[model samples]
Target: MRIPVKHPWTLPKRLLGTFVILASIGRIQSEQKSSKQPNIVVIVADDLGWNDVSFHGADQIPTPNIDALAYNGVILNRHYVLPTCTPSRTAFFTGRYPIRTGMQGKPLSVGEPRGIPLNVRLLPEHLRNLGYRTRLVGKWHVGYYTNEHTPTRRGFESFYGHYSGYISYFNYTISKNNHTGFDLHQDTASTLEMRRNSNYATDVFTEEAVKVIENHDATEPLYLHLAHPAPHSSEAKEVVEVRNMSEVNSRFGYIENINRRKFAGMMMALDQSVGRIVKALGDANMLDNSIIVFMADNGAQTEGFLENYGSNYPLRGLKFTHYDGGVRGVACIYSPLIKNNSRVSEQLLHVTDWLPTFYSLAGGDVNDLGDIDGLDQWSAISLAENSARESLLINIDDAVNLRGVVSGKFKLIEGAADLYGNYYGDTGNNNSYPEYNITEILESDAGLAITSIGNSLLTETKILNLRSASIVRCNNFTDFANCSDTCLFNLQNDPCETTDVSADYPEIFISLSKMIEIFESELVPQTNTDVDPASYPEKFNGFWMPWVASDSSTIIATSSLIGLINILLHIFSLIFFS
Candidate 1:
């Protein structure tokens, strides 16, 4: 009987194993139970430069509220986007390249009616399908040329903003459209004329945004897209104030001093809008659960009066160029999931990344959204991984096709052309002469010499000799062969694009050129609805008759008669001299 009584060590060991199993089961259950879905809000600014924000080292502007987000969240040092509005917006919405979405050219004008194609599914639509409420407030430039691409048809349950790209801050009338009227909408119904002389659009947009947030149901997760069209082109009121300065004397000069002041003011207004949105979320007790993102659509346009006020500084080129100044921008993301508040310098993310990133945050299967070019950058931002995107492609204007490829520290840009040349005829055949190699010119002290050559050619052949030569003849230059290979520069040392380094790095030139061809082949040419004007109600087939005013004499005579009547009436009333 004593021999049969075994020691109790085995019993204790069995008890320890049971306890360890229970602890493991408890840990697994806790992790599964604690998983949560987060809300998302994306605030985008149009044509804002890298130095525009205070957090990114701007002393002229104060963006305390925006800086707070950067301070709290991960500040992305090398984020890239398209050089124009439509392309950027399309990329963000569809999670595909702009060229893939068939938005590769200049923005669809007010006259041209085209929208997001039916085949493509937007981010909001996918989020909505997953039981999230999506709302879009601000400028929707993806489609206005047609009804099919409207926000309602895309995926958003609610839309509040203008269809055309730009509107008068005071009157809400688009200047190019001759003050033709349009109304802002909420869902299917038009809510207001979107025109106000006393109230600024920036302020009004913020107010409407707050209202939208307040109206959203707390139980349902919300995705709010706040797109601000401020700090793009300076408003007339702000322009007048800065144009009087001696440094900005020319109203028509490139990058005028007044433009900067006005742009600063507009940026301030946008910052205030951000403050309002954040405050609204806090007021609703939704801050902790919401993922907030703030970024710019593209680079600043320094042409005309803008250059006198805003400077891309170390970055070469402007909004229309493919240089770092045009594509590189400030991007920040704030979320509870981000463990530390540090700058993320590794990942080279793009606008398309948002779709998959948001889907993962919302606790949905990202693969369910189907094919997309953007990768999920969450792991990179969370410090779980260290990697960057290999290449990012962007198209600025219709005439400029640019491909930027970054490998480690070496960045190469190919097929750089000037869209301004199409307007001025300096480059001759916007298609033929590639004008300048940005990397080459910015690397050397002879940067000015290169620019001077192009400037002199532009002045002599295009601007000064405009009346003598036809548009075709003015832009037809056969001298591209002489300088085509001479314009390349090393961007790492010369970010300002001042020198030509093609002589030393011949391999880079060939690699970048090949990359450019590959990129171009993938692009599906966007149907230019602006060409061959067509009236509404007609289904656009990429072809329309050229716009020609019928009965020109009646229109001219009526205008002349009205002018003559006003003069005669003034003369009779003795008001002309007064």
Candidate 2:
């Protein structure tokens, strides 16, 4: 076929059009190339509470460094997570709801064979495929049974932490199954349990985190999970004692109550850890190009079996309960990509949202994470816009004991029993105190003075160096002693979730309760136990048992059995040869 002849002037016009199209394409390419490859460092505080941070109206305990990070970042005022450690972590790492992975309910004992399902891909695994280095520097509570469930086997390039929930900070031991043994591990295998260590768990984890930052490969991006288990004391101890006793006492004498004093010391040490990590990143000249995300794994654990003595004051409930106090937590994100460095984002977000958020921020498509429950909230977080997530399944227990749902400002929760089918949740710590808006205080002279105690910059310049969240100021919610049936509360008005308005909002209750039934339908049967040992050699579990207090008997029995086996084998061999 022959082309039709064009006018002589058409050639020039066509060339100009071609050049413009190419120029536009070149511009698009340039923008894509210039997109920042931020070094991501996610810092998680175990069982941290809303009122624990000094920036959030807690005057007795100071969290200067954490406040500084919150000031220089987007404060997420409506963040929520699971009611327990492993479920929260599983959600965060997998971008899927913990119930989907059968990780819902309580945390695993150190000796439990259960772990985060091996089939589900983790956030680090996704990042590792994208030319990033991944590391874990604290608790790995999801699972640690056979070698398959260890952190090294999961996707972490390097893991310098314990395999259990919370171990003795100094002794690095966990008490379980009527037995206590070493719990700390350097990589995957347990390190020599010397009974005592010169280093505390918090300090050791901080040191490892600093080293990860300092030794990061500049050419490649990084994704570090600095999961510090602080303000989380050992349930093994009746009276909680703060680590680094002399140092804590020297720095914090203002706190009068010894329990409060000990708790404050733990918080301060964690705060110091944040400062040290930030300093290390700054020293490495990666601060400006870094995306720092700080959050609590769950809400305050409170003075339950753990005696954490944490304050989720102004918020009702505590860890292991399907209530606001147990789910809502402290969270913030800081990066140059964010439009405003100091704004409180009221956008609703979930702990599960982080996997998608971080992957998207690192230039990965979240759509590839098939059938995930987390939504990509990058723009909502970085630009302070409305989050894509409007509703969430806070807790959908497979056991059908406790369940919760959030749609807009309305949240409905009911606790007939805990995950174990025991009647739980009769909230008593009613915080009738008025709201102390620290953000407003920062904008005033009085706030400048209050903020000066922890931040030296505020003292020198009479300016609040920290950023304040933009939440409404009002009185705290009223008291509700019990949550009968489905308790309903408008989170915006009664954020502490102290009132049970289920009687008035029957229609709203019906609507949200319907959602719970639908979600519950999709849940798998709860497996509160572990895989059987018949699948693996008995010798594989020759290590610590959660119930065993010591390894001496186990070692003696194991050796005696091994010798007997050897003698039997020799005799059998002689008989067969004869």
Candidate 3:
């Protein structure tokens, strides 16, 4: 290849060097453009226990995908939400207290018209205004029975899935068809039906989710809400494919063998769903730019028919109770933006925080939205910083009577009458005489049946008495006098809620009680003004909707200006350097 060496011009060599430098600059500018916006995906699991995932010490189930997320991102150890599904979801959606939005207790059945207020802007609505294509796949339980509460009405551009409290995993049902049963829907169109087969519900939800990801527009950033309803029902199919077999037997003694197996199966399917979503995003080359959030709506189901199988042990109480087990949940955020993969304890975050956090991460205007009760934790995500709220107040009752306040490690649970009315010897009929003498029964009980009955009664009484003693005057509102015990505990030392430190720390108890009183007095409505008029048909807005700003023009203008500057700089640099 020894060819003739003509005095090849130094001008060409200089031009080549300039081209190389210009290409390098252009590549850097492209990298900057990609970093401006990131995709977001929030995966919400229904009724998953704190210990159910492998990262949280569930040996009986192999949630490797979920564990991988924790290994790569921040695992929040002190994440909390309301005790039930609807309240937690409402908070997550609106960044406001569930009580503030008037969605408490169980979510409304399908066709019910209640929804997040028009005045309160939802997370997706704000994100959508900022130019994100929002989609919700899976459970939309916020307002199932009402058209006003549908996903499209709540800010989602497209909605897929059912509208009901609970549907069969094999034979899923929709509330729109009177709950008898119908195929899942995408908007108003029927998608699929498992009429004669037992296809797992989680599988169906996951499959549809992948489709949504696959079909998403590549140019516009995507915000997908995959709210899976699985591992939540009493009859949910359990997977028995665990590394540790004995762990299942020891941990889930209350659930029957069959149900436990079914639960395990459901969990396995859920793990697979997570894996699938991750794999799909990776295949699409979107994994590095996407933020994946995994969280349960609340603690495991602790009552009704599913009590035995769903245990929140090591944490007292269950789904409906205002206890750690009911409110505390497993939460984690996976993002390339987060540099460290470690457990974040001490930070007290709630469901409401998701809205502002996601908004800030997506580059949305936080202040343009209405009043929100959450703080943006984007700084905490990128850096190992503690960004949490000062306090979390829970109003489990409409009257603000049954409530709890958690500040730091101190949790003040207001002792109110057991709404379940599980008091021993007190027949639900107040007129009936007490069936058994409380003293004689406690002394005589030794067998499993007697011990169980006695323990139940004692627990109920303790909760009742604690409520009564804490209040100076017992109003029939919460029926504090009917409760057997009122108590306070330093949750820091007693995470299990075993020891009552109320007597030892009377001052702490008094302070918490006074705080509760102040919160109740300020927030709880003394008159009918608290009642939401939207619940009534007469208060309909007559098709009125918010004036959503069209941001595409601004986005196009900004992007075009950036591209033009990059191009012009490259051209000028090449010409001058050459």
Best by TM-score: 2
lDDT per prediction?
A: 0.58, 0.69, 0.59
Q: Output the worst ten-in-a-row residue range by lDDT, candidate 3.
A: 421-430
Q: Which digits, one per residue and each the tens of the lDDT, describe model 2 over residues 1-578?
A: 01112232444787656545554554344344333567899999988877777666456666767766776566788899998888899899998887787788778766676767655778887666444688999988887665556677566888888777887777676666545566666675654453446577789899989899889876567888999878787754534556667776776565555676688788877887887787777667677678888899877766666658787766777777677777888887766567755667788999889888887777666776779999999888876678999999988776657788999999988663432112122221224322334443344322232233323223322214333343323353454435555678887877766666778888989999999888888886665675333322223343342231224344334434443343333334323432
Each candidate structure's TM-score, on Cα atoms with residue i matched to residue i, is 0.69, 0.78, 0.69
- Candidate 3 regions exceeding 4 Å error are 1-35, 144-146, 174-179, 191-198, 234-256, 302-308, 399-401, 416-485, 522-578
Worst 10 residues of 2 by lDDT: 420-429
* Candidate number of the best lDDT: 2
Of 2 and 3, the candidate ahead on lDDT is 2
User: Which has the higher TM-score value, candidate number 1 or candidate number 3?
Assistant: 1
Over the stretch 107-149, how does candidate 3's per-residue lDDT look in tens digits?
Answer: 4543344555544557776666445789998887665333334
TM-score of 1: 0.69
User: What lDDT score is found at residue 74 in candidate 3?
Assistant: 66
